[model samples]
Target chain A: MPQTKTQVLKIDKLSKDFGYRQVLKGVDMDLAAGELTLLLGKNGAGKSTLMKIISGLVLPSGGKISFKGQDTKKNPQNLRKSLGMISHQTMFYGDLTAEENLLFFSKLKKVSSPREKIEGALHRTGLRKFAQIPVKTFSSGMNKRLNIAKLMVMDPELLLLDEPYTGLDYDSIEFFNDYLAEFKKKGGTVLLITHQIDISFELCDKIAIMQNGVAASHMKTASYTYDDLIEEYQKR
Target chain B: MLNKILGIASIISIALVGYLVFFWAPIESSMGIVQKIMYIHVPSIWLTFLALFIAFLCSIGYLWKRAEIYDVVALCMVEIGVIFCGITLITGSIWAKPTWNTYWTWDARLTTTLILFLIFVGYLLLRKFMDYGEQQARFAAVVGIIGFLDVPLIHQSVTWWRTLHQPSTVFSTKKNVIDTPLLVMLLLSLLAFSFLLAFIASKRIELELKSRKFQKQIANLPQDHH
Candidate 1:
């Protein structure tokens, strides 16, 4: 028997350069539907730049990126609706209440019944009581949860997260893991970028190691033990 | 190379205009050499408006296309426009000292221009304070569009209200108010300053592109020593 999965994203020979220095050099990756792929890299491995290009926030200097069988360069706006991103910076407005932030994004995304979606996202993220409070007053953990709430309201087919659990506490981390599992169960695709391998080891279905502007290797988590992955990283 | 050629052309034409204004363009019957500042003042004001108009157009393009190149051009033009606006105010003040007997006045034309300058100053400050990316570009483009609405208002202020600043000479219905030599010099000054604006804009845009590349390189540098 063989496992076959639908490919949600296809990145071929993707390369990005900044002046004399090249960040991504002919990198190729494929993310399948309902799969959580952890992209592991050391600092400055060009993970964030790759995610930015995928989300249409940045353009690649060379190569191609196709999402859902459509070239990103040709149909960026159409592709944007299907992709949600959580990066190092919070995309919410600090002066606006948590509910207001969600409402604003929902309208931009043209979600149906925005009011209902806002309430539902807040309740699910466990921020119902703090819905009316300004985002500036929220704790780091609370803000991270609100970012997840943003993803829920949009209900994107693909989610790209860059260092999603950087400042989260134990409880928040647990909550995030549970949310990601549920999201995958609903047939969503995820490409999580992180330098910390231990944190996302169990949650990821596959591991792709990025080195020298390329994915050096990709392996299934089931086939490789924790120590085996570490040894592999060292070899690279 | 184009920028360099434009820069040289600007210098030559500006020097030619200066010689024509001081020697060839005859002094007015009433005002003497003080009227000469008009050669510098009017052209600076015209070029300022031109730069701002380009910025407005580029801003619109940036919003519609969401391209980084358009945003870079808009930012460059806005910065150049502000510099020209500053030159206009200072030169106008110098001309006013002997002609109007005061370096400063609260006349409608002067006041509206000042307000316009202040608005653009705020625009530049907004760009400076925000982080660079799509959000910054979006916000700046919106501000650029709104701030440009003041240009027409500034142009029409002298007509809408009775001001000590004289009404349009070249654009007025009156026939040949300015002498032929003065008109030639003014037009040449306009051409020279416009060239200068283009040259500066291209240079600034080059710097902007380089700085963006540098920033990314710095970001990719290793953070932890260990």
Candidate 2:
């Protein structure tokens, strides 16, 4: 079956300057609907900054970002409603239980039928047993699961993940891989930043390497092997 | 540019006020030299009202608009209001020590002002300890709005109850409540402090906004990773 994918997000000449230092110079990329894109970059390549801008956390100094054919600056509320971000920070109250955290975030996200949605997310993430326990008691892997549950509850069309595989264990990574596969099968789009090259190549439909604050190269996963991707990252 | 103009105006007016207060204003027969403190004290309290009112308005704007600029302005105004409120308390107590024979009193006006000060001080402390972002801004805005309840109470406290504090003179309807020279000087002092408020507020807001971005920049600074 041959079908053209719709372009959901368009980035053109994106630039970010943190005072004197220029972080993102002129990055351009397009993300199609129902495709998982892995953004690979080194420590200071502005991968996190780009993610932050797309997620509406940080304002870009220059350039344009369009989501669903609408200028993101002109329609920020719509953009926020259409996307969810998972960053290194927990972004949750530690004192709140897993269920409590979801309920609180659900209201913030203005989700319909919050209780039912939260219940399903907890069970799906395999954290139903610890639903009543405070999030501070959860380990790093559990926190990652909670973040995934948050995305499920948000039910956004796009997901922006920053260094999601930084500290995950084998089991957590496996769970994440399975969940991502299921999500992609259901037509969800994701822009993720990760250094886990092997799993990323297997999961991502396309790969982008950001170097010196620009999308240096973007290629299809089927067109490039794992070693080629690693070389691209190191060379950049 | 407006802030700079305000800064110069404040300095010039305050210097003029110093000259007039010491040389031209009448010497009270009863309070004598200590009564001179009223020039600074009254204006401090008046400027406190103005600063806190601005904070309250900005707080409402923040909650309604959910804009970061509103939050920044509200935070700066609250900080300025706290400083003036502290001055009011200290000067009022200093003047009261000789007149009322006590450095502290439980009068409604004094107590209300103190409560307002503490609330805003607590507001600053909350921001200091809490995480920075939308959540912190929302919480601060709520506190700023609720803490403003004491402003009106402080205004009517003297009228609502019999207290050692004097009744409203500047906004009062009573005739001959104050001499023309003293009234003119007090009004001029108020103008000076208002300009000062504008100047400080602009600077604080600028600093706060830049410091926040700088903090984020430092946190995101790149380390060597291949």
Q: TM-score for every candidate vs. truth?
A: 0.70, 0.67
> Which pairs clash (backbone N, Cα, C closer than 3 Å) in model 1?
none
The per-residue C-alpha lDDT of model 2 at residue A138 equals 91
For each candidate, how many residue pairs have backbone atoms clashing (under 3 Å)? 0, 0
Per-residue alpha-carbon lDDT of candidate 2 for residues B98-161, written as tens digits (9 for 90 to 100) = 8677898766667777878889999999989887766678889988988887667666764476
RMSD per candidate (Å) reads 5.8, 6.2
The first chain of model 1 has a TM-score of 0.95
Tell me the spans in candidate 2 whose CA falls farther than 4 Å from its real position: A1-3, A11-28, A43-67, A70-186, A211-217, B1-12, B56-77, B126-146, B153-176, B195-226
Task: Judge the docking of candidate 2 as incorrect, acceptable, medium or high.
Answer: incorrect
lDDT of each: 0.83, 0.83
- Which regions of candidate 1 deviate over 4 angstroms? A12-27, A43-65, A71-186, A193-203, A212-217, A221-223, B1-8, B61-76, B130-142, B154-176, B192-225
DockQ score of each predicted structure, in the order shown: 0.07, 0.06
